[model samples]
Target: MAAPATATILSDEEKAVFAELRNEHEKHRSVMIKMDRYYEGVQRLEHIGLAVPPELRRFETVVNLPRIAVDEVERRLDVKSLMLPDDQIANEDLRVGWEYNDLDAQAPQAHKEAMIFGRSFVTVGSNEEDPDQPLMTVESPRHMSVKIDNRRRQMTAALRQYIDPERKTDSATLYLPNTTIWLTRDNGSRWNVTDRDDHNIGRVPVVMFLNRQRTGSWFGTSEMHDVLPLTDAIARSLTNLQIAAETHSVPQKYVLGMTKGDFVDKNGDPIPVWESYFSGIWAHANKDAKVGQFSPSDLKNFHDTVNHYMALAAAITGLPVRYMGQQTVNPAAEGAIRADEARLVKNTERKQVSFGASWGWSMSLRERFRTGEFPRNGRIRLEWYDAGTPTMAQRSDSIQKLSGGTPILSREGAWDELGWSEARKARERQYFLAQESDPYFQRIQEKEELNDPSILRDPVQEPDHA
Candidate 1:
């Protein structure tokens, strides 16, 4: 009776739908695999916990480096207010945009939160009569956090290299800038805020290393008509000098202002005057007549223009410029001062070990290795030595106590009855009995003196009471 279901021969439309579904499924599966890998890594580390071996940890804080005067550093960098041709400026912007996009593609999770606003805004210099405007007026307020990819890994790598004890390196290395979002409203608003409810527009500091061991740099592009012409410019036109001091080998107490009030006074003034710094990366400023959608060619043209400007700037400065802000250090350490920071203190704890020459031993403790939590318990081994004049065979006579384990935790009631010390003594008694079957160690009396000198001569003697 139905119009004889017109021969449903797997229509092209249905095939297309099936194809789309397949693509989506593949994407989701890939994402799931990646997430699984990430979780597995986290689980592995979490099981290990934060309890690092004493041998691997540096409990001591070393020397502190003096903060560089912001004004002085800015003067040295010499930020220019140069304006480039319109076409060139547009190209630079698009190039930076592409790089940023590439960055996003690589780390979709983190880069999604990034803010790229300056590509549309322009900063001009003073003097309306002058034809050229400023590139960008950079205001350095003491310190700032700039964004970077894999920020934590980058910082840790730098710290590891800088503080390698084997190398005995003392000089502080400059860190790439940790960039924060800097925005302007319309054309004449403050270069800080972006939202109404969010009034703390200055800068949101990102916490990575507690110490000021990292630095940040930001890059952008502007048009020639929007900034100054630097060809005829002199060194003094925009230089602001400040002093940088280095202290001697002494650990000084330097406070990093974590709270806003620490850096801002009641009168709303900055506590320390930072050296202002300004610099630009290569960028292209395209002004195409057509106002429709931009084509891939348009983007490519902009990228090329930016590369050109970056090359020019790098040549003039004789330093790698454009979109890089790697922290630097002076190899000579001429201006550096030495100061001792902190020292490490060692603590001692008494742990028990069993002696079993040519015999097997086992020690066990309750342990739970969770996916995202610390381990419940752990165990270690000690080599029991031969009672005779120390020889390699005597050293090899020890049996690992952890080979077969013991429950670290016991019922509170059972613990109360046995007492922890009594329980430990019981384990020692069992361990001694295990060696009874082996004639070589059978005569090693339970109450006899051990080879280790640390063993007490008198059992009743109390160790340092503390």
Candidate 2:
């Protein structure tokens, strides 16, 4: 059953607070939306408009470098598990909630949005139907905004807005530390409090996932902002190249003394310019007419210019040239490829650290929603897969060497390094324990050990006692 909507009204101060937060949210909404358009390959051709004729505007093309830049980093991030030291139950509880939320699929989406729009949000609340599993949702910055308390380094307030075109209503949920105010407006009506919830969590449930945040800034900087101009340039160059191919791919022909009337078909109707140009045969009664051709324009320069901007974009975004569709005569060696990815891998690790914190905070809120109190004993730590590109064989070899003869790494540590999920690790542990306890298997192992010539040669020796 759904929880009944409370009829609590908002006070004047609460209304003003919501208004302020909503206004702040409005200020960033447009910018975030524009970035989203760029990331989606739907941004209007800004530089191509002047060069491209209006009729050829349909030939405009987008290189989609923003998506490439953001996705390249986003794909490297994957959360393995959330850890609570010495608290297996708490860890398992968080894992259950994490899976219940389908964060494996949702997290990458949030990361991409954060990369494109500077930041994204994750909201946690109670699931009335399943009390054990809290409801967690990934929210885009387009419809959400947050205010952080710099000293505390926490979100003090957040506002999430919604629009219902079918119903012609606008709704918003203002999340405060002590109370949540739900406001609604019908058509052009004034905002009215429709519902409220006072959970008194003492902290806003919304957690912001920042991307490339500066030292002193609360919000993050969009990853696409730096390469947007290059993307435009590439798009413009490609559009111009297409237009040139259409208009000048064939050599131009001129008739010095022939008029339009002279270019006529057998029926005496004037031939269209395109038909006459492509017909390959021409005849005129005027003996003074002279025909000549201009060589077709070489499009190599346009292609080279596009490649130039692509290289600049790759450099600025830490992406390999090949990622931008630049092909080389010789393929890059394995070591060289890894070296090229060093900067991108390091950047991905930084994002994992930053975004991991927000995910951990959101899970903590999930725990609070589940138990009505936060876990005070151990801290929540999110475990992420290694952001580098190492083959499975390489990872296995490294794990074996690290775990072989020294106490440098443990079994669990090896499993973590292998990026195995907790469930798989647990299952493997169960199988190992079961095999060790099997009597038949132990008897067969003992028979083989007794038959071994080395064991016979090194027969057991009893210790001497006084």
Candidate 3:
């Protein structure tokens, strides 16, 4: 459910911003409702056919077609790629920020939320210790109120406060980093008239990481909105199709214009009637009646319609038709499978770009939180795990190519490409250096580096040119 339009009655100035936010909230909520309907698989319940008398439905069978709530698009697009720390780690300020979040464990969950909702909002704040790393947090957009500098496309001010479900009073207040004491004075009672207050956690510490943003909107767009129509149409079609089968299984029975007494006994009492009786005998000298055939066309039509709509849905979403469990003839070859995934790969790359920028800035803000002063210029960037996530062989091949190039890639560069953690790389480096210094292994190292068989010959013996 969306928060009430008049969730808060702000002063004249704040009113404008609140109005905009309320508008956004309503749209987001509307999208959410449609998405919920798709997931529940009940979109067809309303479209099923109904007889004039509801009671007639019992005798005439009604079928409900299967609901194909295929959700591969979201899954394929949202696979969590590791967010690696970038060169900015070389700077003391940024290094701390990278480690503070303990992103190794936290990233999978964060990525999942952002992908599911099409966006995730983050805030920067202090950690227990260290300036190198600042604490970054993800806040729910539902509880947030943000003011944007449209031209700058940045958040100018932010507020997050929750009201009591029962008393309706502001039960909790989370002061935005930007809601300074000065701004609070202007907001008046709306700002400080809270039962609870949070002291300064340092400037308004909120930012948005849009999941594939839509045109002319601050909120991220969800994939759910795109597929909602298809899901609804398919579900409705399925229900009607299934119901048609049962209804037609027993076609309309007919009796000749025989007397009404044919249904009654001579005592004038109504003869026992089995309405569902598909077969019976009416003995007469001039008999001429036969059971009507139930043509299989109706059921076939419904089945075909369901498949056609499902194919259309697949087309609209760019989801592979094979994923719908409709690929029945033959298993696809590796090349075909890769081609099918090409569009999804491109989609994921786009997400990486948008989300990567947001995460980078969030880390920068965290570094600033650690040190009261913001670093003038710094290298702070997210290390995105490979979206394609190549197998071991692919990674190794790429690593070799990169390292063997002109102006060879640094050891650090190779390690990063290999997705090695700093700790693991450090251990490997230490072991490498130790081996180089060992006299016992010096001959082996020399021969390995030289790649000459002559080194294996005895020092006193002459090498034979066999």
Candidate 4:
């Protein structure tokens, strides 16, 4: 309920941090422009279609074909299957609160959109009137700044900027160490000196969403960067494709040779070489008069080149070649389909691990909202769906083997491992438990557990049940 980071003045060091942050923010804005262009399928003719040559314009009109945007495919392919899919937030009370905050529906969508900009943040705090349900909202990095301690070991302060449309002014909130507002500035200049103290993480109340982070760096890179060069290449290919189509479709004209004597006499009389020399429809009195037909050769070459680049884009961005919509092939085997997406699956898993931490931190912040405590715990984790899944077989052999091999593993856990939905798993678990509840099945299961040597191994430690 209390405001943090409200102050009228800033220290010299704090001013320096703001100066550096503003500079870095400019770079982020530039990158976002490029990323947005690709994400929205707005690959431009800005560079490739600029100037037109006079000769080519005479033969075939150049047309801009649909831009083959690799950015959205790459970004989506990386995050689409990266759903946390975890039961971590299945707490009954928190479920209501998550829905109350609209985070249940929007979290996944916001996370993907944030990845496009390379970073996002979630601000978790509470309103005085609604103390029971803490408020949490996702924030774009463009509107926020965070300053960490010199060692980079801890973040001590944060600032949020807002532009008031009605007032047509910029306002800033500089929050500090004690969950207190250190500074409040209204309608300030861009170069205005920026306005930190808290080790209490909850007091900061901002959790950063950073994924696909490169080593030795704090910033994350989007898939747009991975295939940025390919966007131009793909655009060039499509443009050439249009040129080829136009060239092959347009008419070509030529003339056949005839006797020159028919052109004129020695008296300088104007004469036509043929009955209709320039008539467009040629006719000759003493020679052949026909329009020559032109066959456009090697038109396939243009399309072939385009297809090659599209393939390259697919490979670089981990998008399936089928997404290019070029050729038709028979349905692929399950293994082959999985192979095509192997790179994508790996990328998605990496995102899950990275964003999992961020989500877990957000959950922690959500708790901080409910309780006045800065943090409930230092350790947190999120469960993620398995990579390379959506198997054709709902109940796999490996799942059966797992159940038979580990008596300690719950039936529901085994089902979940096979990528079964919670609802399906619940139904299957109930059916199995009902069947196994009989004395006969229970006696058989006991005998099997007793026969397992791993369970009898000298003082075997209890394995953690999934």
Candidate 5:
């Protein structure tokens, strides 16, 4: 067969299509470059930790916490259940300090009514430092009432939920809440009313935990009664565990096993250790040790406790123990970011458009979009007056002004036309510019859309079908 004839000619449309494709490829390459740069910047900020200056430190830390915890906490709490109830009552009348109030005022009336119903409010407590040590006494409200029986009941219920059924420990037998707070009002003028204060405020248990071990285990320790020390010790131990988990180089399972049980070698053999030499990993402040009294005692104990755990895990796992860097933002970038941020903000003499609205407007030609509501046409709309449609003026003005009176350029519609330009090309560029100029603003729009674009649509009424 004769060799295929050489291709002769291409249509104008085909040429345009090829050119468009080329342009798209170039756009994609440019985007990838920018994204790579952005990712590198983020990685540098993350891995370098607080190497960034003061202002950015908080930004970095706040973002990192939840991202790191997401995989960890997902199983612990069903996130949906943690949401506060819709009708949850907030005691708005309560203030941190005493405020002079008129008897006729709504808040005073509410407070009086609550008092009549035996509802107590939280009061600002005094913080008095212990003269000799780095300790402070924090006093709770003197007028508050607590129900000990009710609290114990709730604690028992919670215990039952998590406890093993076969090995049920009697919650009461395990040393349940025993601590109580007795409160009395100090209304000097109303002696009779004040006299009944103690009666109105019932004693409530201060909850605490106990550490229990198996019967044969040499590690079984007696149940201590102090609530504060127990809490402190537990908190310290948890902190130590957190530090170890953070520093460990091996898999999470290995680190967890090291903490909960005994550390094992690579061969799955438990390291035999004598019980006598292994002291408890935590210590509490001794009341007898004053600040001036120096034997390098309690502080040393605390420091040693933290350091010992950290060092042990680090040595075992071969992970470096790194100190937290100073919290500070980059001085050089602060001024520039701030300036760009301010420019990104729009200052109006009249009503101010929010960043969200500005972003949506920037992304589309929908000038009639207000905020919330949906129309029957099935587009996420922002406006109520025009029902998400662009005004005629908007369409005309946009086409003329944006197209710059160029005869060769194609004009889709006047700017006011609702959803006039749904073309992917224009929107991509618009959103891309938005992302480059303000990552935060871009993130908000992306998040809103992700959650539900129609969420902002106004609720509509339906005609009765019957």
Candidate 6:
């Protein structure tokens, strides 16, 4: 636990490496920004300002399907705890670090960001104030990037940048396996090394979580990518529906052979045509002028079009129709609801598999930071809550059947399957062992054993035995 060596200067080679990694990070900025806009429901509004007329732009609406699509999948993924094969409960050392970092709240944020932007990062470092609890943080892709060695399948370097608006400067941290460099620059100044730390941990402390990554790809695919276009379409449809309601919800009227002067107000100024039409009063001195009305536009087409795109989005993203705001007259039965969510549940499980590995790696890094040694013996695993939506009765029945009078599943394993936290399971275990050791309970058990017919018959003398 000696403090890492710190310096205020970087070598020429290190400077070049930092520059390259920063440039690589810059390459993903635009894509992440666009994804952010979509996730925040602002991407379509940007287009509306250009496509919609100034007066009608206010009526433009956003359906926010991207957020819904991402959230539907994100809500199903919940990492409960970390465990090793031989442990009855979660790893206490890792749990300390996890709670120290408030990961119960932050982990979901990281997961959602990974889903939105294809990847997110976790950085692990030693906490100088408390050696036993390491510092862990979840980083958004918007500000971080990593360089991976394809052959080794490891991150060789990582860069995290931040803009200090209050100071009117920008700063970045470049992470290497053995060194960490901090650089800063003013609005127009060159990059200067503020400080550098040589920790020599032997591996990059950044853990990258990829969402739905394909083979041979360095970056994962964003969950919002497929739904973005459909989301835009839905927004446009809703905006148009809003515009139609504003302009044509009421019957539009036409006047033949009428002069502009006929629509003048009491102030002798010409009243706007729209104002006169909506005012519901038409007066003219010309007797020959004629008036006729056109029927209001049918808005059902817009609703149908929006619903069509929503259905397509639901189908493409494996989201249920109800999640897309489509409702049925009859409430679906529990079985039907579960069936509709099968694909989504499966997809969530896949994400859990992917993110779970990164989390385990991060916690392992935390252990290294704390104990100065890597976890090498048992397999480290992250325990995730069941992604499927099963009723309590159903879950209980299933667990009972699996653990009842059989060695197929251990008692601890049954508790794990029941979604009990490590703390709760530990408490229950204590109570169970206490009950087994109780004198009254032991006496009752002995009495029951003595009165059993099998025990009474076992004492019978054997006829032919020696």
Find the candidate with the highest TM-score and give its number. Answer: 2
TM-score of each: 0.13, 0.86, 0.63, 0.68, 0.15, 0.83
For all candidates, what are the clash counts?
55, 0, 12, 15, 24, 0
The whole-model lDDT of each prediction reads 0.24, 0.80, 0.52, 0.58, 0.26, 0.81
Q: Give a tens-digit lDDT track for model 1, residues 210-291.
A: 1111244222211111111221121111110000011222222322223434344447665553411011011112232111
Best by lDDT: 6
Cα lDDT tens digits, model 3, 363-439, are 65665555555445542455555545355564456666887855455778777767665556768989999998999
A best-first ranking of the candidates according to their lDDT comes to 6, 2, 4, 3, 5, 1
Instruction: Give lDDT: candidate 3, residue 296.
Output: 47
Model 6: worst 10 consecutive residues (lDDT sum): 1-10
Winner on TM-score between 1 and 6 is: 6
Residue 146 local lDDT, model 1: 29
- lDDT string for model 5 (1-466, tens) is 1122132222354334333433543443443343223322333343332254554343331112112111111111110000011222211211111122221132222222221221212111111232111111111111122222343433220010112244342111011132111112123421011011111112211221111223332111121112113223333454434444444422221111124233344475654443211421122123332222112212345455545544443332222233111114532443443343231121110102221132122112111111112123332212211211123554456677777866533333222233332233356568768777997887887887879845555445545576
Which TM-score value belongs to model 1? Answer: 0.13
Residue 90 miss distance in model 2 (angstroms): 9.3
lDDT of 6: 0.81
Worst 10 contiguous positions by lDDT, candidate 5: 190-199
Ranking by TM-score: 2, 6, 4, 3, 5, 1
Where does model 4 exceed 4 Å of error? 3-20, 48-90, 165-168, 180-203, 255-290, 374-377, 392-395, 401-466
Model 2 lDDT-worst window of ten: 1-10
How do the residues 179-202 of candidate 6 rate in per-residue lDDT, one tens digit apiece? 777678845657777766667899
Per-residue lDDT of model 4, residues 172-234, tens digit only: 555554453333345555433233223254356777777566655555665456556655666
Deviation in Å, model 5, residue 81 alpha carbon? 18
- For every candidate, C-alpha RMSD to the true structure in Å: 34.6, 4.7, 8.2, 10.7, 35.1, 5.8
